[model samples]
Target chain A: MKTTITILLTVAIMAVGQAAVAEPVKIGMITTLSTKAGYLGEEIRDGFQLAIEQEGGTLGGIPVELLVEDDGRKPEKGIQIAERFRTRDGAKIFTGIVFSNVAMAVVPKLVREDVVYLSANAGPSKLAGDGCSPNYFSVSYQNDNLDEVVGQYVSDAGHKNVYLLAPNYPAGKDHLAGFKRYYDGEIVAEVYTKLGQADYAAEIAAIRAAEPEAVFFFLPGGMGINFLKQYAQAGLNETIPVYGPAFSFDERILGAVGAAALGVKNGSQWTHDLDNPANIQFVEAFRAKYGRTPTLYASQGYDTARLIGSGLAAVGGDLSDLEPFKAALSAADFDSVRGNFAFGANRHPIQDLYIREVVQTEDGTFTNQTLEKVFSNHVDAYAESCPQ
Target chain B: MLFFVEQSLNGLQLGITLFLMSAGLTLVFGIMRVINLAHGSFYMIGAYCGATTMAATGSFLLAIGAALIGAALAGMVVEVLVLRVLYRREHLDQVLATFGLILFCNELTRIIWGRQPLFMDVPPWLGGSIELLPGLIYPIYRLAVIGVGVAVALFLWFLFSRTRLGMQIRAGAENREMIGALGVNIRLLYTLVFGLGAMLAGLAGVMAGPIMAVESGMGEDILILTFVVIVIGGIGSIRGAVVGALLVGVVDTMGRVFLPSLFRIVFSNAYADSVAASLASMAIYLLMAAILIWRPRGLFPAHS
Candidate 1:
């Protein structure tokens, strides 16, 4: 009777230990995977998949399960989906959102739930600033970080009498302000076009009339594509050089913009052509799997997965241990696609930003080629304001 | 003076685009009394066909032909299969059915083309800017669009006024039951009218392909604008569509360009700019509201 009781106790203890160590890590990815903004989410999801595939379907030594739900680019939908993942799926680590608005919706709830929110994209400034939570970590740079670098590049290049264009929105204002903070040149004119306004003929006409030395814009997604096409159509691309952040010149958009995007300088932290072995492997594998060059969103997604994996490995997959897990995540010991990636005090990346020029490659496909380093070990502007 | 000329031209170009979209929508709603929320899907289909054919054949003319035929045929099929039944039903039912068709079309597009936006380049012959005035330059492709819109409008006018089909269409719009009782094949007329409307939408899509990103749910973006244009122009009148399109276009363009600067004279630059931007976006809606209050049936009510 004594032997039987001892054996049963031993079995119970072993089962508990196994549950702590071998329970498959479930990560819930809430993103805009459908509608017009679906492409962004698609790229991010593909990158996340690629990282898992590269790791042989395991993050660290533990098996990882990814639960993906489409937010449809709506904040309400994102919040609902994230809630489902938390309650139904028991997902503690959440990742992947394309829009900052969607991120703003769910991140607070995620923080309150004591879940680790790994932002692959949509690093809104609010989170970077005083609202920064210890539970939240952005694998991607803050929204203004790339624009800041572009601004600095424009200033350093000595482009005088520059004109700025952006959609009339809070983000647009933030982007222009970020640029103006670094650029010491004369802003000949500042134009805020309507959000989702396709035709830019009037704006183009104004640009021609002004005839600034250079033009900078912060139009992302379809807006950027439309503006660049119209800019080229208006014959402005020939005389006036264009500068923008990498969001407007990413690989997904280069195909649509085609030759028009050529010679345009944009700032980014990661490019496909980075020399690091991890990045080289990632780019080649991504191309082989997806049949196109991965955008910066994809790179960020891949990095997010690896970053989480590093943390998981350090803690031996015991995510229930919160303090040690956070510390492990902050360590960021993975080989990043962007070389020399490290976390700042705010838990956003402090990495090198490069000025990338859109160029037609030998194969005739347009891609962004790294021109020069703009900011090295660049920390986000709001990091100091972050209490965490 | 040059800026004024250029902006006016820009406004005119916008008007033409709106006309192409509104003409078909107005026709469908005016004649059929069948609310077609899916008309925008035909526009999207036209764009997809244009882009695909343009890529396959490398000929803009061939792409245009394909777009028109593709959209018209798709319209005819949908009419025969789905919209035919809705003709006898209430407007609410028609709207619900057509809205479902919009969702269906969007999903179908995504399934076929994937999520990436297709790029359609202007043919080399129409790629450059034309010297409109001494200092002002406008895109040749945009001018081509204007020309096409004008040509189509004239052709539509001729169709309605001079031709037997036009007379029949006018008669059918007036009294569908009367035309049906007078030994006319009402079903065939309805199909033809819907096909023609779809064709016009396709033409607009083909023309817009070079300018805008061709992607899924693109139809929805312009769908609301087309509705506004139709509502302002008088639901079923082609003349109303033309006038309304031009008015809305000019107002919207001018407002976007000049409002902020005009306000800056009175208010602080920052406050003025933000307010102006918001007001400019609302300018068209405000105009529509005012017009509706003055003339409840729109600026040119077709039936009256």
Candidate 2:
């Protein structure tokens, strides 16, 4: 009996040693977790983790290792993390950046290192414009492309005058510019609040004076919540109909503002109520695991993970097959939360933009419902402008 | 002319709210001589409390009341438990300890309220727009805010310039040991002063809740602006906080509104738009820097 037991133990030890030599694929995830930014980062982490778990902890016959590093919402920290991942962690692919500046900083580093970077949430405009690079593929839409729909919706609806407001930063400027692109209506005024400002009284007062037919804005993160709440409080919602991109009216923000977001319209590429097979599965799995409604950020994150999965699979488990892997991702053969989509010439996403109305769910939870569809099979106008 | 009048009102209103925040911070600094970086955390707590209570009870007044009281309670608890031990400690220790409090409180707030923002909204009756000028219609909520802020400032002025407790607070601010020798209960007074400061900070947070996001780190952002107010107004002066806050708010507002048009005359429209946006954003910091260059101690310093 003792001899038999010893033989069995020896066989188990040898099998474990063999497993240690198996090929491993490492994907670096730099996110703003463990901070207020974690609201979105947690969603990103969950989406990636869920995809890996669904694949039974393996991607294309190799065990996957997700190395998550906190960027702390700092652009410099993101680059540092990406450099560390490339040099030390032996990661061949980089993913996840919730803020645009962080993505702006890390995208070049990953490209310089010849490592593929998948932007999960941030939609920096330059990456789809003059700064476009081959190694950088966005699993998300351009920041302005989404906002362009909001401008178009308001302008086409014959709104004569609109007010524009955003935080005083690069993202905010891009947002206002994008809005004016599709919106030919007379812009009454453009007000830029301080970056990360908590109060909007002066801005609110300015909005009051503007008395616009409509208001279009792009103030993501905490800024969005402050603007929306203050706008609702100042009774601007009743005076002028508000329109924005996905960030202003998403599940991530609705809970905080709750009924304050009621009647607010936002343009997005996807919504939880998108009524598609891919989205249904994605939403179901996310809700089941998280016990809450997933935001557009989470949906985009899940698509990015699937994008990485397809690239890995197409290369036949070979991490070194960069050419074949890039081609597979470019072909867009994988499932996405936004349904059928493909990367344009600039490597930015070309997908449908959905106009969602902020409405509470049947379960009394705050969520956005798809009201109308805008910009079907939308290709970013910046693709032509891109010097790539 | 009407726009200027309206802009002045806007500036004054902003100043008053900043005063409410800065008044407490400066008092805590001047009296306690402890740099409480987590002071903003208490403000956030008050805002959250105000928002949650208002949402639950559907009473704006009650929410404000709960916010002030709750903030005071949180402040006193910190004074007794955490800050009391640090009274005789070094500035580095005080700063580090308070920094830890900020992290702990921010996370605690997140755990309680979740990651989403809470909509502490304006009451229905207070949420209508008033036609102040022919073309300019201002929200009645803002007008109410102005009234409240001004009243609070006046009330605070009276409290400090009048009552016996105010006298004791002034004495304490002048010299803790001298006041202690005069048979004053220094410990109780410190807690009371902290509680009062916290209540004022809470008042600002609750008042601003309907106009801003009631979330974790909300106070931290405003805290920086309030620091600018203190630097501009002079520390530990209620009057200075008011003046500084108003100037910062109005200058910031005007810069954002007119800078683009001003730049449009010299630069191309696209360049002016981006450049103006960047400068407008930096205007307040520039003003702060300029003010510091002229008056290193502040416009109205309580101490020489």
Candidate 3:
């Protein structure tokens, strides 16, 4: 009887030991989860969780542990979070950041410390270009990529004398530059407003005076909502069409802007109506879980998680083999929601960008409907500058 | 000439909005001698109330009514529960407590409304743009804003100079203890005065709803500008607030519109733009500084 009891106890101990060995792989998620920017971060986190839940709480056939931290939209706070994740948590995989400047501040430190940094939302140009790292991969498009597509489409559609508006900042300047790269037509006026400027009446008056064929803007968040509301109120929506990147007009924004955003065309890598299996599943699952349609940021977040899963699976749940892990990530094997997803040499997304029009669904809800593909497996212009 | 006229109208529209916000702030400080840092929270509450009501009821007028009532009620509640305790306290205590209230209100708003901005549509009747000049058209809503601001200014003037309550308020501002001893219910008066100030802020919020994004923290941004206006106009002076609001608004709007072009005369377009952009934002502060240098007690000190 004593021998039998000892054997049973040994068996129980072994089972517990095995379970401990197969503990969920931990990944650090540093994203803005407070303030107005918190919405973007929350959506990203939700989408990411949706993907994990769809995989039955496992990534790459391994139970995954996600350590989420709020950066409060501060770069230094992001750095601090990254440090804790790296040193204290021993998390080798990092993903999810909403702001470009925050990501810019946090990414280099993570990459230098040998952590695989998967960007879910922000795709700063510097990271995509000369500062590209082998360990760093962005599941999101480069900041200028969508703008470039929009610029091309605008030029192709033969819109002459377009007025441009963006905030006075780096991302804003990048957007205008990206637009100018393809748009050969004369820019009637290019105006930069103060960042987070609530009133756009003066700018609207200027736009009306310019009488451009079209107006392109890159105001995100509340600024976009304010601008669109004022633009619609000024009766410019009916006559002068507005064009922007998906950042300006997405599912999240369209809902807030209501009918005002309708008929606005935006360039994007993913929309809710994409005829792709991955996207359909993601959109349905996201809506079911979050009770709202997924925005571009959400899609990027989902893709980042899925991409990490693919890489982890290929590496056989081992990130210690740096070459194999990097190769696995670079293989870009995941079925992307954007449909034809690949990575450029710079490790940013090389995917089709669609020209999506804001249209009302059958249920009176406004959402982005894909009009046509603007670019097929589009590679960013910064690849030449990237060494890796 | 057409450009200048259009810009000026835009400036006036902004000025009127600022005036609505500053009026409440100045009045509250004048009568209560309470530094209410959380005044902006009332503005946010008003905008939220208006936007939510507009969305639910689809009546623009109802939205305005809801905004005023909601903000005023909220203000009275805060005064009874919080401000009543701190009236005799130091300014620092009031500042700290109100600052904490700002955080609480912001978080509460986030929980109630969620993080996404709520939209308030311009009423159909007020949506159309009028031809202010032959070639230059301006939105009628903006002109309405100016009209509302002017009317409110006159109403405030009357309230200050003619009414018995106005006299009491002025008397209270002059000597709170004296007014208390003169058979006036000080607590009730304070509550009523705070409610009035909050209602004015709500009016500004509802007015701004169509033109601005009705979201959390929306009040704080404009609050800073309102403070600047009040300071330039002379703290606690309604007439000073009006003058300061217009001055700051016109200067800010015109600076934004023309500074880049003005700089382009000397520098290249890109260089001029970056330089002018910074200066344009700072232009209001510059004006404030100039005003201070010229008149240390502001343009109109209420005490004087």
The predicted structure with the larger DockQ, 1 or 3, is: 1
User: DockQ of candidates 1 onward, in order?
Assistant: 0.72, 0.56, 0.70
Which tens-of-lDDT digit does each residue in A1-388 have in candidate 3? 9999999999999999988887678899999877776788888898889889998988878689999999999999999999999899889999988889999899977798777899998988899899999989989988888898889899988898798899988999998898899888988767888888999988887787778999989998889999998898888999898899988787767777888898899998888889889888888989888899999888888988898889889877787766788788899998888889888889988888889999998998889889989889888888889994
Q: Model 1, stretches more than 4 Å misplaced?
A: A1-21
The digit string of per-residue lDDT tens for model 1 on B22-108 reads 999899888999889998999999999999999898999999999999999999999999999888899999999999999899889
lDDT for each residue of candidate 2 in A63-150, tens digit (9 for 90 to 100): 7889998898899998889889999888888889999888888886578766788888887877888888888888888888778898
Cα misplacement distance, residue B202 of candidate 1 (Å)? 1.1
For model 2 chain B, the run of ten residues with the poorest summed lDDT: B1-10
Candidate lDDT values, in order:
0.90, 0.83, 0.88
Q: How would you order the candidates by lDDT, starting with the best? A: 1, 3, 2
Please, what are the lDDT tens digits per residue for candidate 2 over residues B1-304? Answer: 6766766776666767777888898888877888888889878988999998998999999999999999999999999999999999998999999999999998898888887677767788898678887856677877888888878888878888899998998899899999999999999999999999899889988988887777778788878888888888887776678788888888877776678779989987667766887898788899989988999888888788
Worst 10 residues of 2 chain A by lDDT: A198-207
On the 0 to 100 scale, the lDDT of residue A94 in model 3 is 94
Which stretches of model 2 miss by more than 4 angstroms? A1-18, A59-62, A204-211, A362-365, A384-388, B85-93, B130-137, B254-296
Question: iRMS for all predictions?
Answer: 1.1, 2.4, 1.3
Better of 2 and 3 by DockQ: 3
Each candidate's clash count: 0, 3, 0
Per-residue CA lDDT of candidate 3, range B127-198, in tens?
A: 888887697778899898899889999999999899999999889899989999999998898899899888
lDDT of 1: 0.90
